[model samples]
Target: MGTKWITFDLDETIMQNPFGKWVFPEIVNMLKKETDTEEDILDLIVSEHLQRMSEERFLEAYDWDDIITGVAGNLGAGSVIDIERMVIKHSESPKIYLLEDNMLDYLKRIKEKGFHLAAATNGYSKYQLPVLQKLGLDRVFDEVITSDSAGFAKPNPAVLKKLSDDGEITAHVGDRIDHDVLLANKLGVFSVFIHRALPAEVLAYPIDERATHPSFIKICEEKWHKENRLREMPFLENECIPKVVVQSVEELAEKIGFILK
Candidate 1:
């Protein structure tokens, strides 16, 4: 057999979007001019966006302009907002942090174990490249494959197949079952689901517990519920299922070590 390889999903698997807290509030402010209540506007926009993302068909279609326009139309706002400006502003500020404290060290150890590492993510290189740099992981991966560069996205096996030309992909690890796990399964590779709990900071949106907005609290609760529901749902025979599930980088390292063995 050729050298073994292991692929990882970038967002939410190894990285956390610390800047996501600003997105909802900024969007709420932008829509406030067209709407009366900021709370209702926030709730409606978040709910609509999440609903779209939950659908499998819309997985690769993350067009914020379309999503924002749809939300505005639902509110009878007539698409007055400049969505292109908003998307550009947020897309450029792609800040990310490691999901775990020891993630960098763990990745280094994995590299030391002689397995080829690849970042098989569904994002533009313009955005993901800077994130990897910021986290000091730009040089860690043997390959960093992005949707923009690969001409496709996960759960398409071709994205991962690009890395398998000279090696055998032993396993793939990611937080999303729909994308990462599905992609791994398609390639007949072991899938490791990393189920990290939502951070308290993300849940503590609007940043003030004393003046907590009902809409913010509701959104957080609904997000938690949806995450749990996705995890508990039964996978159909046609749907992809992970070979193993892990909750932390420690468990992930152990699992990968076992796979390599």
Candidate 2:
């Protein structure tokens, strides 16, 4: 057995994206349905604005008048084409996710342990990278594999293979079993599940070990979806499963500390 590399998911495992992050899909779904009410289309933004404290601060700091002008200018409000400034305003409202408490420190520790790190996420690189940049999250990983960047997304061998190459000791950490863990298993790397708030009965596989504290799923409220929870999957018929089932990165370092030796 060789030393392993560690791969992490972005939104739930290491950071808190408070802007109805999971519900973005639901909002997009409304757009897909072509809902008539601007309110209905933008309800997620309003709901999140009223809910998340970080976003409330973002709203307060934004120059409302400048925002209005920007929206008007960008959409060409007076042009022959139609415009929905109200909906646009809600949609563009500085949606953001911040670092988990001391997560940067944890990441640095990971690097110090001499493990190669990569980010294996299934979302927007354009949107996601900015969040990472804001929190210095970008510094943690030597590589970042976004589904979009990889072209085929998660549960796909192409996306997983980007990190799997070069013989790094790679393990996948993600909230979605279907997307992240299952995909990692397919690629022959170790897997770890965060158990973001999923019912035990709901899982497709028994999580290698369940995290009791700092349940990352609830911390992000994405626990309702499969995003916050991570399921450490067992080795497939041709793969290997990691022995460590730790609550935090610190413990992961300790359990795998021997690798450094």
Candidate 3:
């Protein structure tokens, strides 16, 4: 099959966002201000942060005020409104993103291989475009389309169709299977999922030699829920499992190298 275009997701795929990198410290301090003594709230903060990170759709269902109200009540905070303000302020911290280690060089090598590159991410163009520039990728992508610009977001056929209409065979890569892999499979394009690594327990089992067991989708869903059970699994149709799952950007680069070659 013809394949030329290679698009990527932004946040976790090409960048690393440390746990509570933006809000944890501010939230802790804000809570401490209302109480004379600090309570053991770090676990609560981490749980809330992980919920926000893993449950993408759940966050949109409610506003920050609602989120803060629930979190404050759970934490028994002195001021709900004040905590809400702090939460909103810290949410903006994602704007300060750091590129993955040697990701620039890795992407450059792909470009040198003559494959067209693009970024298809879910966010407002106003915020997303700056992150690319900050990561020195504004010029790297031949095209960068945001949900706001496209009038749609990931897992939306409209966005994928728009990219496919370019008439270049294409593949989309990302860390999340429910979005990236499902969308690629729906469009009948190559699906390359880049997982960081196998779980410690499963690491010993050779992926190639393992007997029939849980699907990758199941494995990821379990981990996702365990880390953030507040949100339900986006689990789309199992019919669209990724054609390839690699452990790192380097492994993906090598696979892409084969495709381009």
Candidate 4:
């Protein structure tokens, strides 16, 4: 089969939406209660959380609980419970927004090449669908399938299989190497990894802590969660790496061998 269908990962693959805006400031204020807690220290903690989200090795050494525990350090800080509560609250109900506007033109270009487009994301309808609507992409995407709708998440094989049951030449495009690429590769479908711009918050985050200003965070959350799942499933190998990797969508058409008008 040729490339007749294209599936995308929503959060960072196309859009960069961060949840828990309250998390950073709240943690900073609480940290100051236990110790002098310079903004630099809080920035370090924020950077750690981000690294934990992106890098598997960093996550293995520390998690959200570890970060908080390191902060309080046996002072019996009552704020621990409050902080955990805050994380849980915002994490469950994230503040979703569209960070990239260029995906529309990219999707339109692919669609014009006679390929159907679908969004296969591991997010909730309440949150994910609204972002698409806000970006005016709700109608543009042929179908939107989320974890809530799919009853399975990525790397599950079931999610990709469900999409393939429709019998179309499918190509999966996402930012995460482990999640989108692994899933597509597992299913023997053409996979493309689009290295979208990193969030500004991540790039501008304090010095040395950041690799570079991400030119791009829930996107980060999704990465962390996906990494955790991959870790748990040790048997799963990334046997199928992406066939192509492009920095932007404009470069996607030729890379994927799709011709646009």
Candidate 5:
């Protein structure tokens, strides 16, 4: 291969979603004024959301808009027009943090070593691009490919294959085994799985008896969805296993350097 490249997954791998937890709360507040009791409305919406998540095929067919529409239907709420606008606004300007300290510096060092970097993620450019710009990584990657732009999502090798078009992809790093590792293994690229601890906000969020129950919170935490996908998918025994596993992004940086050397 003439040039070596490394690809990174965006959401949980490079950035933490602090804004995610607030999305439900914002939706609840928007609908609260329509109902006589605010707490009752919140609890009802949470319950409806939990019911949908508990379904067998939820993970495979999950869509936020659909979930919100169901919630509105269940509550007999007037219209989802305002709710849709709110969701789009929140999605466009997500408040996020780097998963590791000095992540930008680490990526810069990797670039200095002459390795092309690409961001292969399963989101729209409108949403993912803003997060990159906020992280000051707007110009970091040689290519920023998303599901909307690529017409393929993770666990489908085509997403990663796009990066391989310009050069050989030496490794792919991400937080999900089902999506990220599976595709990398299929493509014969080194798969590095980075495990991030759940954020304190997620762990410490008060678990109310109804609205913010454990099951409801579980669906809210994206990490839970990742783990659930691993369990649900059939490739865990063979095809989806990662070549290396690290607890933090700092450790991932160290492992990447050692592996490439």
Candidate 6:
């Protein structure tokens, strides 16, 4: 094979998107209950977003108790641990989005062709595997590697370098422009940018490929349910790259084939 292996970013590329949005509303309610307020939740939301926007330390994952107190104080929620309990109890779901259609078939074909697949993500394997299991991509991926696993995140060439030695063709797919597309270019892999959970402004950044279809969509209702919940990351059509831009995994697979063959 010309391209012996391919790497992937886990969060928005293959499964449901996670922007901490899911936990926002519940946090607001918790703030209100704890602080005793009939006020709208927007204050709480703005407070939280600003709080973690690079002023103080920002974390991808956090404990329930610390977050509640900080957010409550920021938004003037006033002593709300019980509400924190409510938010923690129902804040997140391990079950996330799955693939769209015919994508899984394409992966099976690639696997039959003897291509290697690995997930190089910024999250942890333990947390991400559950998400993959929910999407059914967990079992299919030959190797699963993450920032938590590797001790670093995207835009870092070291993670991509781990996929293969020099002289082998590698392809990377992901949703973030700055993190995925830009980094892959530097790492010398055929890179794809996904618009699943992005916005027009952010997506306008150029990527080697603009992907429109899921690489591993399955037909099961459980899979479909997850797809429905995928955060709508969008992009501008004007985004361009020196390489070919494609909309489906079949297209990506073909590109990899030509390069590797």
lDDT of 5 by residue, 1-261 (tens): 567888988888887643356566777666666654445655665555445444433332234555566666666667664443443455433446776779888787778777888888775565566567767777788789887677777767876666677679888888776668777889988877665554455335432112133432343244444455434433333455466555566655554566555
Q: How far is candidate 1 from the true structure (C-alpha RMSD, Å)?
A: 9.8
Candidate 2, residues 1-261, lDDT tens digits: the string is: 444578887776776643354334443443434434344434443434323222323222223233333333443343221122322322322454433466677777877776778887765465456566666677778888776677665566676565556656467766555555556777766666554344443333323333222343343234223322233333232222222234555445545554333
lDDT of 6 by residue, 67-95 (tens): 55665676665554553334334323542
20-114, model 1: which lDDT tens digit per residue? Answer: 56555676666677665445776666566556555543334444455667777776675466543443455433434687888888887877777
Comparing 5 with 6 on lDDT, the higher-scoring candidate is 5
Runs in model 1 lying further than 4 Å from the true structure: 1-3, 34-39, 42-55, 69-95, 196-234, 237-240
- Judged by lDDT, which candidate is best? 1
RMSD of 4: 10.3
**Clash count, predicted structure 1:** 0
Per-residue lDDT over 26-131 for candidate 4, one digit per residue giving the tens place of the 0 to 100 score: 7666767756644465666656665654543331222445666765664445555354455444442235444445668777877887788888877656546655
Query: What would the TM-scores of all predictions be?
Result: 0.67, 0.56, 0.64, 0.57, 0.69, 0.60
Clashing residue pairs in candidate 3, if any?
none
lDDT of 3 at 81: 60
lDDT of 4 at 182: 76
lDDT scores for all predictions?
Answer: 0.65, 0.51, 0.61, 0.60, 0.63, 0.53
Ranking by lDDT: 1, 5, 3, 4, 6, 2
User: How many clashes in each candidate?
Assistant: 0, 9, 0, 6, 0, 11
lDDT of 1 at 135: 72
lDDT of 2 at 16: 60
The weakest ten consecutive residues by lDDT in model 4 span: 208-217
Residue-level error in angstroms, candidate 5, position 65? 3.6
